[model samples]
Target: MPENRISRAKLTTDIVLAGVFGLMSLPFALMGNWADLVAMALFVSALAVRRLAPAWSLGIAWCAATVQMAALRDLQFYDFAVLGVLYSTAAHGGRLVKWLGLVSAGVGALIATVYLQVLMPIFGDTSGLTPENLIAAAFILVASLALLVLAWTAGLLARSVREGREVRRREEVANRERALVEYRYTVEQERNRIARDMHDVVAHSLAVVIAQADGARFAAKTRPDAASEALQTISGVARGALGDVRVLLAELRHREGGAPQPVLDDLGELIEGVVAAGLDVRRVETGEPCELGTGHQIAVYRIVQEALTNALRHGDPGAPVEVRFDWTPTGVSLMIANRLADAAGGPGTTATGATATGPTGARHGITGMRERAQLVGGTLSAEPGGDGVFRVVASIPAQPRSTA
Candidate 1:
């Protein structure tokens, strides 16, 4: 692509140079006088090399033509060559070159008209205009005006094309960057879906198994029959949890509609699983319950689950976590807070809590949580609490875009 671009640039430069010099050589090439043959030869040769040296080619062509007119001692019809040089310089050269080329052309025309009409006639009638003069003058004037307009218009068009190409290149780069951002977003969303499913399955399953094991351990000597029943319940809960996990894993892998989508109603089961783990939770609700869209409900459920999980990880086991939901006039607000138990801190060691401990709390996890919230036009915060408590708070706007 780079080589091709360089080649095209060279070709465009050659075309511009050729057009400029072709005009410069126009007047000398039009003459039929035998003495003008040498000048015409020089002009033609310069035209061939114009692409290599435009200014030199144009200047040499104009000078040779002027010299030939001087030698003939007849400047008649030479004004056309000067006009051609002026147009060429204006189209291809810089501001100074354009001004000088035009001034020289205008002066040359005035001098040629004077010499051809007055001075040259002292030797002989070399005016070359009489019966044919009016028609020749009209043709030259019209042609020069037309060529000048054409060259200026062509230069404008070339500039516009260059600008348009540059704009398109920039837009193409921007589009590619936008596509990459969207792809990364999709991947992250899918990964979050998988992670939420894993937490739902594993955490709940472990809770039930641990509860049964604790019960079995306590009852092993005195209530052997109750211990066997607890073991049976463990088997039942494990099978059920495994089935749920299998369905979730299948959905995560996108195995052709493996499970029905879970919504707000399914949150009760999630809460029950944590309760079965012997964690004390108090859930308070406000406003009449209404069916929410699956995606919104899923976002809500995940936010709540994450908050509760953090509570379990950081709060003392004996402390109760409070879960509150309020559907306000503007949006929904969810808050989870748990008081820390004094026993959680070892002697001379302060309980820093999970928020300060691991990657999930300090690094990528909170960032991911915030991302999920923002994706649904919501806001989330995790902060230290005075009086030995930690809080997780989130607010999700109702009719998301309406708030925006």
Candidate 2:
């Protein structure tokens, strides 16, 4: 498609050039009578409106030229006004206009050179073909060709500038789109991470509280003292849940707040707490003492805690649960696996202080655990083991992890 804007701009410049050239030619035309002066004025006035309508301007200039030629009975150098019109047509007009303008410019130059050199040879008495006249004709032809080349070059430069600006605008828009996409991706990842952490916290805490509460209610008649102890354990578990939640909330505000940091070393105490609710837990380790960072230590502690809670809820009652921690040269690895229950546990009941089943298979609890492991530059996998047993295994690097 043609660029109307470029066409319009070139047309405006054409009109201005026509006006300046026409006015400059007036002094020479005015050496004649009042008729000549008035005609020149009218002709120049028409140049101002060339851009308003290019075809009309060409007609006007042509008609004025015919009148001027008639009154003078000869053509002068100023007869080249039509050349300006031709250039405008080639530069800003249609394809048909361009071809017509080029032909007209060439033909007009030829006729004017012939007329000036042969018919009206004012410079010399001899008017026939001569070396001087031939040289003048050659120069005029060359000048016309130069003008054509100039107009074409100007048009190309204008088009190039417009395209450059357009390309820059597209690049800016692409950059903005890329930034927006990255921002959305970061937000989604963060939301998933928070969801996983919340699932682990709520599921483990509620499971422990419920299990203790159930045991307390059942033993109230047969063993009143044991039942009171179960109640006390439930209260302690609830308080600990509150503390855990508070610590998590503080973390959201960029503060750890001197909260008690749980680590692998605390596994025994954690297991004892569950056993206090009348559940059996067996702990095992396969590594020497290793110093772990604060955040990673908490992460490892939570992993083991969540696993034991899961076993309590779903594993065989009175069966054994194995908790293993292996510290290797590369990193620390944790595994928690329990013997499966032959008979399904009661709904929402656990003597070990845990839920009978997790939120559903595709829910966030287990998925959260896996993500937490990954966040610390670790890997976690949970699935069915042999003979109805479920296993949760995690390997987290001991080196500095990526905070992001």
Candidate 3:
């Protein structure tokens, strides 16, 4: 049999019953009514263990019934313990035990009738009953059986009602849990949308400004004319970056609507901006361009944008950042790699020049990149190499929208 767990409330109820009914038995015990005293103990045991061990409670009640009949003790008010036992049996017992309780009810009524009519006359004072009083004895027997059946049947009905209530309560709790889960999912979706917009605006624009500033420094040494041209590029790029940051900030202040996302067509402008800032960077593209959906295109653009941004912030300025794309009919594969900066850090300066977690540590930049990949039905992993190279690789799956 499986073990049934009982709650603290139920155990407390059993303890209370044992105390109340155990004390109630004292009156009978003092009167020298051994049968009533014994019945009291059995009935209290039934009440206490009804939920915990219903079968055992039923057996104890039956033994109490036998003692009362065998002693031919006159029925006392405490004899109501029989009805309490019968009710508990139906309410709490298993299938076999409930049926046994019903049978015990019938047998107990028979024994009660026999004791009142036959055994009392032989052992104790008969009072008014005699062998000649056939009609009276018959009436008594019928009424006793009726009350016994009523007690047992009442318990069965009560059990059915209690079980129905329990079933309804459980369903209510399940519905509440499902609603909570759906609400959390909706909140998460909205947060991700806001995050994607902010990442695109901040990371891409700053990468270009940093690249231009670096180039101006290098050109200032060799050619004054070239240095002047680099300075102009830096001024224009910084204004554009500032404008993008303002737009993202506005979107953050009012979350009801969203700003436009970027796409693959923007890649050239993004890379050129990086080159103007002055990093040694190269771009490689292979295979015919496959048409990607807006969401997938945004994912591809943002991932590349973030990778390039990180490269400028953490890569050695003298080393080249290789951005490569291997496009196929089904998907686009991207790889970006550059030599990681030594403990000295990169030569680029940004609006937020905080690179404490640069190439080797944790940063929000990596998290945003990974989220973008997942949004596009892809996987991304960026790892720092033992050989001082940091590489980010991603594969984004897409199907031609005409087929979709």
What's the lDDT of the predicted structure labeled candidate 2?
Answer: 0.65
TM-score of each candidate structure, all chains considered together? 0.62, 0.59, 0.58
lDDT of 1 by residue, 27-126 (tens): 6546556545556555544444333344654577667666676665344333334444444455445556555555555554454444454445555645
**Candidate 3 clashing pairs, residues 3+ apart or interchain:** 211-277, 211-278, 212-276, 212-277
Off by over 4 Å in 2: 1-130, 138-148, 218-282, 288-302, 341-363, 371-379, 386-388, 401-404
lDDT of 3 by residue, 154-229 (tens): 8899999999999998998999999988877866676676666566666666666666666668878898788788
Write one digit per residue (lDDT tens) for candidate 2, span 1-404.
Answer: 33234466766775687678767877777666655655565556445554454455556666775566445445433555554555455545566655665665566556656656655565436555778977987886677566654654454455467679889999999999999899778766655545555556676667777787888789899999988987888888788778777776765554223546666678678888777755577777787646666667767877887787777666666777777888876778888877655434445633332344544622344666776787778999887644556678999778653456
Give the Å shift of residue 319 in candidate 3.
8.6
Ten-residue segment with the worst summed lDDT in candidate 1? 1-10
Error of 1 at 37 (Å): 7.2
State, as a TM-score between 0 and 1, how close model 3 is to the true structure: 0.58
The best candidate by TM-score is 1
Q: Give residue 29's error in model 2 in angstroms.
A: 13
